[model samples]
Target: MYLAIATDGVELQQPERTNELYASYWERLGPDEITKLLAEHDAGELLPDFNHVMVPVATLRRLAAGRVPEGWDDDFAAMLAHAREKGWLSEDGEAVRAHLERER
Candidate 1:
């Protein structure tokens, strides 16, 4: 999932918004593997004026409100554990680090 951090605010970005998406990173998750951007990709520094912002992990869960299958709890938990180990979670352990990817 990708969260776009625009000049106005942070929100979940649609896949079609390919360019100028001041937002987060992407993940290629598989049964035994997960790949995502590096921590350096956290793009709050590229923000024009607002403070460094991060997309809350809670939001990610929200996105799963009606999309995931009936048995994804374990997978979700594993993802969270991985995020924690990488120090990608916010101090409260609620947000995930994002990246800056725009059309340059």
Candidate 2:
């Protein structure tokens, strides 16, 4: 599952097939503003597994075009809990960490 912040709104897309992930990756590119905003970060943060980025939940909410999909609420909460335990969250718990796969 992935959250896409597009020109219209945020879309939660789940590919049926594993190879579909590649198609979804570049189907519709996000606005340059997204990269511009990310580039503003001077000190990059990393999690154990990947080049992780710590983004404020508030920011994600603001960028969100819609509510979380049904049945995903608990999963989202669990994700946060796991991040917190892994020290992937911010000191104040205002931001959550996400993997930075690559520059598009």
Candidate 3:
């Protein structure tokens, strides 16, 4: 089950039986037997690659806290240009001005 501990000090747990299958499978195999089996299969590529670009959770929290880093203005300008090219932003001056004001 998925679990989450919120920053506001709330603890949450998923009430589900998804882990039952895994529990039964492990029980039937026994811990030591499964350990041996895993050791034998360790020579083969059994896991998928998890290579991915990601920002740190802490860094995201800091950014959300309005702690803008150096060069943020340049980055934001570039992002705005890209968004404009993608037609996500309105072309009118008043709309653009209002959007920028709300962002700050």
lDDT of 2 by residue, 37-94 (tens): 3444321223345344555655544443255455454565566677788876788888
Off by over 4 Å in 2: 1-35, 39-50, 65-67
Clashing residue pairs in candidate 3, if any? none
Give the per-residue lDDT of model 3 (tens digit) for 28-74.
Answer: 34334433432342211111221111112222223223444466555
Winner on TM-score between 2 and 3 is 2
RMSD of each: 12.0, 7.4, 20.9
* Candidate 3 structure, TM-score to reference: 0.28
The digit string of per-residue lDDT tens for model 1 on 1-104 reads 46543333344544222221225423322212111221233322322322224555666566446665665566666666776777755688777655545333
| TM-score of candidate 1 relative to the true fold | 0.49
Enumerate clash totals for all models, in the order shown.
0, 0, 0
Q: Give the whole-model CA lDDT for all candidates, comma-separated.
A: 0.46, 0.45, 0.27
**What's the alpha carbon RMSD for model 1?**
12.0
